[model samples]
Target: MDLLTYIFFAFLFIHIFKHIFNILTQKNHPPSPFAVPIIGHLHLLKPPLHKTLTSLSHHHGPVLHLKLGLRNALVLSSPSAIEEFFNTNDIVFANRPHALAGLHLGYNYTSLPWTPYGHHWRTLKRVTTINIFSSHSLSLSSRIRNEEIKHLVERLNVGFDESRAFKKLDLKSVFLELMFNVMMRFSTGKRFFEVGMDGDEKKRLIDTLTKILVPNTKMGLGDFFPLLTWFKFLKLDQKLIDLHKKRDDFLQSLINKHRNHDPSISTNDTTLMGTLLSLQKSEPEYYTEDILKGIISMMFTAGTDTTALTMEWAMSLLLNHPEVMAKAREEIDSKLQRKNILEESDLANLPYLTCIVNEALRLYPPGPLLVPHASSAECTVGGYRVPKGTIVMGNAWAIHRDPRLWEDPTEFRPERFAAGGEGHLGHGGYKFVPFGVGRRGCPGAGMAVRVAGLGLGALIQGFEWERVGGELVDMSEGSGSPTMSKLRPLEAMYRPRSL
Candidate 1:
């Protein structure tokens, strides 16, 4: 045979051997749909991504795998599968994926949410849990929360006549401002939205914050195709860089202002920043400026919109179901025992109100898909091999709405969470994961529940709410947001209830 024939035969033999080896050694991967070249299954991902993912899961089963461009993803939509992953493989899946947002917006992945699971992450978690969200810290902060709720109620009472006519109010803005103020007070001992405040500064601050928090649903192309990032065709990185600079500058200004103030003489020393600065004095190594700013930013970015969105959603649900609203109000009124205002401490006794908030969280979680987790090492989940570095996401929204999990799952029945109901919030086994589950569950769950409960109970006690124009408040979820916000800003008619 000639040299060409020999070479061809050799190549054929190698190819055959390789194919046989692959067949013998290939790992058992989860089910996946047809993937096209280059883009993989990215085309299947549409706006309101949770819903889109749910549809895919329905067709492919709960433990579905997909190739997202150059990345691999494992999506779990069933309680049993989700329980297996988080419970059995929690450590293996504790790391977060290196998304572009984490790089630019997360202080280069050092922020609490984006940091890898390790000592630094553990330290950050400890600080936040002990200093900010602990029962002791929350108890200390109760006065701040109560004062803010009072301001919110008083603001809502403005311009009301004795007749108590319903007034049209933009509840989205109302809830947002209340939460921002509450968080701001916790962080800096300042309220940005008080009446008679400097309008220009308030507008400027709100504009900056709104721009910073605006959801950019357009995933950067580089995130999927790393090589394309070098070209920078879309300028997503540049935009994020600019926004980060704006955020950093603003936070640094707060630090400097507090630094210049004498905490010994200033009443503002009780703020979260002041406490951190004091800690910095004692433990400079751990409480660096970036750490302080990261905590503050986490509190604002993670805490504010989500808590506010929960309140707005709860209110919208209450408006749509007046019976539920009335029941909640009755619970609050009876619990208060002639006291007109709802306090944070009162929330514990108002189980039905708590149920209402939990139900709202169930129907529309702030994060429909919990923060994505990346596997640190290969692990078995649902008896399928999830390779190392594969991105894992649990579709909490789908699980929450799964008819198999709850009867009349789509209905607005807070009673499902009441005593003798299917389950209570935070107690159900992986079935109720609005705040996620396992090692990486949100540390701020306690604070979030308190804020939501207080705000919802206050509104229910203070207002006789009605749908505007005799039409239902739009309950449609907004697209392109990291949080599940209403597509239409919630508008409703509310008048002070004559207590």
Candidate 2:
């Protein structure tokens, strides 16, 4: 009886000590709003999550903690705070949050974007950087980008009304197609999303891609509340399951096509898949077909959509601010090395155009929250304790529009990026992380910049664009994950520019 009493006392003492330790560690945690049971701040969240979080940051300081359902999210809105997270505590937050998309679309979390920081992920990152995103790799892909831009020019020219020379064209589709074609040509050596191919196949591919993408964009209930994952009688999970099947089938068909092809017969062998296939012959274990598919998946989803959205947003901003559009056109026309066709290299000559693109990125970053990083271990952010397993998000949207960091933050001022610009991409540390920062930042940033700049510059140089009507284009923010896009597709009148 005495021994039992002593054991009970020891157990009680240990529990008290642990509770005290937790209290001490949590003392410096960032401020949070009142949270309810189970759902926490999940109810406070609304669509266009970036905007919502930006508002929250304004109230709860630049860095704060929130209970997002069962998940704890540490949002960093200040530039210095973001720098500390990505710099000093980078490796700690290098891990990715477990989401349904990672399970379905990310190839069971083994893919580069979804995988936790480790040897395998490191290998994928190295392969992506060296083989795809390096300057040399991009230089090799220049021919493809140039060819696709010419196709865009031709598409725009033919679609417009001949008599008036003004047509209300859906530039959203045009830019999307341009990006899709560029990505496909780069990845699979095929041109998809262009006019006059197989109607059914086109519809199938577009529909399938849209379905797959829409789910990822949604802030699903299961993500914040894991218990809800099993109770998905709501059909979200079913839809995802269906999407996974379709995507698998589609990608498998492409893989089989490459697999069955006779290497000698294929004249165009410079495709990314083809290159990977060749690598597979030597290192089959490391460079498996699944890894190739994962790489393709990342490239196709990331490469196509982000550039398309940037171009769309840039075009929309220009349309609303006609003076900016006119100024950009003037810059393009005056200094363009090739008046007939603007090459990717020509983007360097147009400083104003670069400013326009940068400003557009500032206004609407493709990935506003920088892809939901997670803390692998406890760390300090903004001098506060960030517990292990907490979600760490850099609010690029907030930082971009922070009145402290930018003058006329809401305005479309491309000149802000000029000599006296308040926020310079290079100088602003984490203040201007549109493409993100540190180790887990987008690896495809180099290629994405080249594509967006060239695409935007060429469109400006090649066409005379006018807003459809006197009314301003509706710049409503849309739903997207890993990218923020304009809700309404940009429609505008266009005519070919005279040489």
Candidate 3:
């Protein structure tokens, strides 16, 4: 009985000590709101995290640290802080933790976005940058883009009328087709939209992809509270597993079929899968089947909704601001009026068009919070010691709009990035980084900009766009785990050019 009493007393003493230690540590770290001990500030997050975090940054200085449940998150909003990461500690901050969703999606520490910084990551980056995402590959893909754009223009042209006749159309389908077709063509040498898909099949494919790409409230129970994971009745685990199976079945089938065929017999350039498959023969271990799938998945996930959403926002911004729209259209008409189509080469000469795209990205970056970046080693960011494995997210949205940096930051002003105008934040440089900065920044940024420029320039040149019912276009943001999109689907009336 005496021994039992002593044991109870010791347990109570240890618990008290732990609480005191926690209090001390909490005080030393950056100041944050009073949060429930275990849950941290997870409950504070609302639909548009970009806005919320930016507001928080305004209140809590530039570099704000918070306890996100068991995870540690650092939100960097200041340019100096961001530059430090890009210049001084780029490699140290390049690693990323594999989140539960990433695991359930079958990436399992293999995806380029989640892979740790090491040989495997280096190899994958080399393959992605050099072999697949190279300048050559992008140049080659221009033909595919042109073909898809032709279809888009033709589809819209059918709505033309000499009088005040315009068609109110859903652009979601058009953008999805453009993105998905390009992704598949690069991955499987097939186009999901081009050949024999019925209306229902096309809808199903689009629906499935949309469900996966957008963030949902449904994922919270698992992400925040792991104890609930054992209860499979929720079926969250099963849903993710099913998504994995469906994705793999489709991708593997393509890889297998390509493996059987002779590359020499194919007249077209080898797809990304073909190149990776060929490399697999030379380095089987590093280039595993899952790794190949992860790479492709990264491209698809990274490529689709973000690109589509940016175009949607660009058009939305133009619709809301007719003056800006008029200026942009004038530039497009003057530059490419005689030509049958807008070429990628024309992008360099159109500085104002580039500025318009930059402004759009500033307003709505595909991923408001970039793919979670993890610390590979101990480092100090903004005078705080960030231990290894601590998840670091540089709030791109907040950085883009920091009042300290930008003049009239919230307003949509494309001229900010024009040739002579001081770019974002009143700095005479590429101050706004929607694609992110540093080595782990989105590799497809250049391609995304070029595609958006050509696509937007073409639409402006070929058709006259206006809001439906003459109502103001709502610029409200939508909910997503990883990306920020327009809450209301951007619906606009388009009429073909009279000329």
Off by over 4 Å in 2: 1-25, 159-164, 194-205, 213-219, 227-236, 262-267, 425-428, 479-499
Give the per-residue Cα lDDT of candidate 1 at 260: 83
Candidate 3 segments exceeding 4 Å error: 1-19, 23-27, 159-164, 195-201, 212-238, 260-269, 424-430, 479-499
Task: Kindly report which residue pairs in candidate 2 clash with one another.
Answer: none
Rate residue 55 of model 3 by lDDT: 82
**Clash count in backbone of candidate 2:** 0
Q: Candidate 2: global Cα-lDDT?
A: 0.75
Query: Which ranking of candidates, highest lDDT first?
Result: 1, 2, 3
The candidate that wins on lDDT is 1
Model with the higher lDDT, candidate 1 or 2 = 1
Per-residue lDDT over 321-383 for candidate 2, one digit per residue giving the tens place of the 0 to 100 score? 879877886787678634467787777777788888888998989888878889998766666
- How do all the candidates rank in terms of TM-score, highest first? 1, 2, 3
- Comparing candidate 1 with candidate 3, which one achieves the higher lDDT? 1
Deviation of model 2 at 221, angstroms? 3.2
Residue-level lDDT tens digits of model 3 in 106-191: 46877787677788878788888886567886887777677766666655565355454566755666677778877777676667
Q: lDDT by residue for model 1 over 152-261, one digit each (tens)?
A: 78776766665565667666667778888888788888776867655467557665676766445245666776654655655747877888888889788778878887
lDDT of 2 at 139: 88
Pitting candidate 1 against candidate 2, the one with the higher TM-score is 1
